[model samples]
Target: MVVPEHRVFDPASSDDRSIYDRLVELGGVHVFDTTATQLHSLRALLPTPPEDVLGEEVRWVHYPWRRSLVRVLGPRGFRLLRLDRNRNKITAAEQDDMARLCVGVVGLSVGHAVAHTLAIEGLCGELRLADFDDLDLSNLNRVPASLFDLDINKTVVAARRIAELDPYMSVVPYPDGLVESTFESFMDGLDIVIDECDSLDTKLVLREHARRRGIPVVMETSDGGILDVERFDLEPERPLLHGLLGDLDASALKNITPEQKAPLAARILDPSKLTPRMLASVPEIGRTLSTWPQLGSDVALGGASVAAVVRAFGIGTPPPSGRIRINLDAHLAAISEVEPTASGESISPANQPR
Candidate 1:
């Protein structure tokens, strides 16, 4: 569990114990100081006098999980330098507006990449992450985790990584994945919700709530870079999942067997849209593979794609509700045809679904 109170420490605060004394108490803790570089960058960005910029107080952020302390500029100066490269393209004003939004992500497999990208791009001020499962050893193929993270709750792993990257960002982790009990609070105050969970019932439930609340929902299928967006915020009357699972409610999906889930999933994610490799893997799931295949590259690409859509929503230029494929294979194909076994042959055995 992430103790939000102890996440970031401000040495400038009027604490009873001095920061130096506290550091001495917590011996062997690694301390990182980047205040000088941050101040220099701050000076270059602003026309304010050196004295004024120099007067900006430095804060010490403590990462209790890592037993490390980092010295950084205050929120204003830190954000300026952290997001400096987003200039003109994402203008400072746009970034500031983005920072005010709150985003929630469910199912931490693909959601892990989405959450990390959101934090790295400074797209949201707070992130609410919910995933019931722990990090499995086999999840490393696409999950942004490691051997040490094995067996740890996925939400905690993701939240800790985000905290290490930007202590200023608020991350709330729900170890127990979403259920009827926590769903309301999880959806509360969220400007956008990203569904990456594996449960078909949960997906239906998520949209039911989002539609009622008029909150937009985004989902990315690791196959074919399929991105699904439901602008419930703009069109409250819109059908869930673009009416793919016509009038099917979560209640009907409860306790469904694996055999029953396959056909419904196909209906939801049209079989015609599935990549050739993914379509082929469907029958072999129980025979050769444990589950559907997802590649790290595809997960990473989906992360970038989702971040772009979320950013558009933040800037109030969100695309219409629908599904779109950002298939890299189709876009980056060879221009000329070649005979079998020819040099520079594109076909490879690794192209099969993992």
Candidate 2:
């Protein structure tokens, strides 16, 4: 049983008498049982005597069983009763498994959306949130924060909100983004990591770290309507990102200048296969340093969809790895699963973005 640190329970004060006393104070016990056991149960279950009174007579009431009976039979008893009501519908083993999941989400921009869904779904026992960016006016359009949170860092805001939503949820906030120095501590004792950061460097680092640690990762790329779930637990013979960047190390890859990176990225992305609408944003984005283009609606869609995938994975449902693209424009979605070629070269898809 998970015990909440702060449970709401109010004991009767000197100003307040027992339920039977309050009931008799009205006139008589009009709606109460006559038998001792039933009366005891009724007295135990009443929260403030149902807002009515019958007479004024101080009766001997059992104080010990009051809270227990209320918990088991009162109007708000569903909080406790629902646990067993849905038992047959959910596997006992699966519920037990879900209660033990600990997931770390990096980047609180879209991650806030993911955390909101996960906290509401009661999917994780503990959530670790990381981000260094502060909330800006522009974030109001998409992030969970508002104008009130304008100056506050996202991780701090997200942690407080998560606590308010579910007090039992253990939330650890890292005000700094995960870098080489912070990676080990942040990744420690975590069952899974969800990459929601916008930095390609951070994504690459997280993927490498997860691969090294043999942890599974579910990353959401709202810009491309892509959700990538990588299962390092499977121990694929080739290195990580084999299907995306081939077998080149980060140092070797970074030595290529921006001019070279562009064509390489274009080749890897194969923009020739992109629809005109998809290509339209590229020129505008290219003028501004080639940051990825994201549709506003993709944030909500990707967050909710990826959260569902995470819950499914948590409950032991098998999900495919690699990129799962949901093209809202075309009302189409596809899963591309790739394996390294015989020569250990990555197989590039025509429509995938670099």
* Candidate lDDT values, in order: 0.85, 0.62
TM-score between candidate 1 and the true structure? 0.89
Model 2, 255: alpha-carbon shift in Å?
12
Cα deviation of 229 in candidate 1 (Å)?
0.8
Question: Please, what are the lDDT tens digits per residue for candidate 2 over residues 8-34?
Answer: 222334433454445346652233223
Clash pairs, model 1 backbone: 132-177
The best candidate by lDDT is 1
Model 1: ten consecutive residues of lowest lDDT? 334-343
- Candidate topping TM-score: 1
Cα TM-score per model: 0.89, 0.64
